[model samples]
Target: MARNAEALDLVELLPRYGLENYKPNIEINLFGRLYSAPIAIAPMGMPGMVWPGGEEIFAKASHKARIPFTLSTAAGATIERITELAPDTTWFQLYRMPHNNLEMNFDLVKRAKSTGVHVLILTLDVPARTKRPRELRNQLTIPYKPGLHTLIDVLPHPGWMLALARHGHNSFANYKKYTNKKLSGYELAKFARQRSGGTFSWKEVSQFRDAWPGPLVVKGILHPNDAEKAVSVGVDGVVVSNHGGRQLEGAPATVDVLPAVVNAIGKEATILFDSGIRSGLDVVRVMALGAKAALSGRPFMYGLGALGVQGADHVVNYYTEEISAAMRQIGVHNIQECNNIVIRHENALKF
Candidate 1:
């Protein structure tokens, strides 16, 4: 995750001369619908940990901003709750379970549809859960069994503890349909490793296509060839991501691979970028390369943590403000113009 942050600093934006007269229109189109900006809140699990009502806060903000709000299946908020928060502009990120839980997976998909979510973002990167001893050592994994050490660690931050309590204690609400009992701490972590089961499959594309009636986006793609494969499988979009560098230790930075995937897939699929985006400038940087849109996660979490429900809307507005400022500096109007901007700085020069 630190590397993901470091990679963004290396990407310097080159300013274009003399096009500053025309106001940069930040509007964007995704899967035939128009949005106010080229930014969308990326799907993230357990956001409530960062803020009391993180999921619904983001949903409301995204809805007000007229941008897409993606809900992770593992997000503590259920599909029903997320849609209720942002019925019209909701998207869902799905994690397909292994062979035994295939039916359960479809049932979850059904639940997502019931919420009127239009886009199904199938995350292909989480092949399996990687072992992160830090989370286990702190007892911060699912079910979040707070030991004496955890109590000691969290006692200083009463706000976080209270928010965690109010948000219902890290239970995976979407997964509740499968089993009433909640899995937490080590047991939850163990289940993650066991549930990952296998990698992406071409055969599964047909299954998803047959089941979903909306635009299907395959996320977590880093390689050009995989981008080609995703388009060949008939996905409407491909998100260039590396799971925020949380899953793979030595994977390529998303910024490094965005161009390759976009170049390879071309119009076959809409190329979206994720994993390292931190601001409106970062969003502009990726768009100037080739991505049609950028999805961000951490920045909004930062907002939620700082200002509660209002912070969510504040962040969206803040990103929009930043995007407009960045575009004015770069001299572009609208998202399409950013699609093929010239890279003025070869090695991310400091401006």
Candidate 2:
């Protein structure tokens, strides 16, 4: 019965099954670099808090899966450390700093390039650190204050506590050498606000394009006109995102806006989509609309929080298998074939 149920679910979810049959290939080329799959891991900040050495684990999984893994600016591990773990698979995502620290941020990009990162993803959405009420409730702020509440919370989770102990003081290790400010929970928030881009504009993006030699991808674009502007400013790609809806409450799903963004950019710029992508069918749906690739943030983080590195591996494999099955059922051989597939929505009034 379970097998029957699973089969029915697949058939119902994927109706692009019969018009024409072809295999789906997920390979993608970005600025002369080839990737084995059109899927890339979106940058998740402070993965270490969720799992012991989470960044390295994800990097290894990406290398094994032959997909790109982006390291967040606020990642627990330094850029150099992540690159060392997955030399060929690393991409760097930068959160542009304040104007006063702009040169320092640019220097950081050069440093990332020096460490062998090929792709530089510039995150332009964070005007200020949006309140994450959950973090506040859990007392999971930066520079982790080991308060009685936090200690009590972790007491039941001995394994995670032990791993945290072994990992040792895990504050953004990358920035410690530069600033003497030790970032604790609220302090981390304050520090981020201090350094983050509040006035970042397209002019800054153009400057970054001229400064950085590698492929530049601007993330956090949700509008078609913004995508067009990005291309005009000489960006190589635009990641269609609403910052996983963490930044705003009522932003449209990345899937819904993907087609317009792709059309606006035309074929000259690469269009990647993210936000609320929970399954393989979601990936297929967005790609069909016009995304060159699809990336997810929270799903992988859930896997990491649940099973550490092994959890990360399981999540990637789950997506790969799901995508493969979707291709076979849809009768598409590769990504290109899948791109030509379409879906029709029928009215629900039935006798």
Candidate 2 is scored at a TM of: 0.87
lDDT of 1 by residue, 38-138 (tens): 88889988787777778888898888889999998777678998899888789998887785647867887888777789789988887777877777666
Error of 2 at 294 (Å): 1.1
Off-target runs (Cα >4 Å) in candidate 2 are 1-23, 99-101, 181-193, 197-199, 344-351
The per-residue C-alpha lDDT of model 1 at residue 25 equals: 87
lDDT of 2 by residue, 1-351 (tens): 122112212323344445455446667776687777677799988888778788888898988887889998878788888888788889999887775558767877888889999889998777767787877888776546668996687788887878877875354555554565654545654565467556358998898898888889999988888898999999999998888877765565555566678778858898887877777776776666677788878889999888865887888888877777776776777777666776542321121
TM-score on alpha carbons, each prediction: 0.90, 0.87
Per-residue error (Å), model 2, residue 126: 1.3
Model 1 lDDT, residue 88, Cα: 77
Best by lDDT: 1
Among all candidates shown, the one with the greatest TM-score: 1
